[model samples]
Target: MQTIETVVNVTSERQITVQLPPDIPTGEYDIVIVINESVKSEKLAGEKKIKTLKFSAYPVGLVADNFTFRREDLYDR
Candidate 1:
């Protein structure tokens, strides 16, 4: 089984056309289509706001205050 993802433009006449890769054999196969309304609305609006995640740095005291990392520590000597 193979999966291919691609975007298709809908015509004003309410039609959509999809072009499959040449490697896909010429035969009838079961397929599924999913339409994302949220994505369509964002594209029509012409503007989108991106949300970013913010983080605060604090010491949890998981290690000693004077602890340091060394390459040798990664393996048992």
Candidate 2:
């Protein structure tokens, strides 16, 4: 697995997004994503979990306001 750090510009229509690998296997997994912390800043403004995809190691389309992340096709669509 790869650990990636990226910057997302937040504005009137943008929020931070953190995505997983494209292919996920079946099992149990945990995910954590945070945003808006510069090295000089002292507070942790954002720390969140992608909490819509059923929490299975394999799921699909974790989403929130202006943000989304996915790694698998959890449904038959």
Best by lDDT: 1
Worst ten in a row by lDDT for model 1:
65-74
lDDT of 1: 0.80
Number of clashes in every candidate structure? Answer: 0, 0
Positional deviation of 29 in candidate 2, in angstroms?
7.5
Report how far residue 52 has shifted in candidate 2, in Å: 45
Tens-digit per-residue lDDT, 21-68, candidate 2: 567666786756665456325333344333455555765654656553
With candidate 2 superimposed using the best TM-score fit, by how many Å does residue 37's alpha carbon deviate from the native? 2.2
The ten-residue window of minimal lDDT in model 2 covers: 39-48
- Model 1 segments beyond 4 Å from truth? 47-77
CA-lDDT, candidates in order = 0.80, 0.54
What's model 2's lDDT at 5? 69
Clash pairs detected, candidate 2 = none
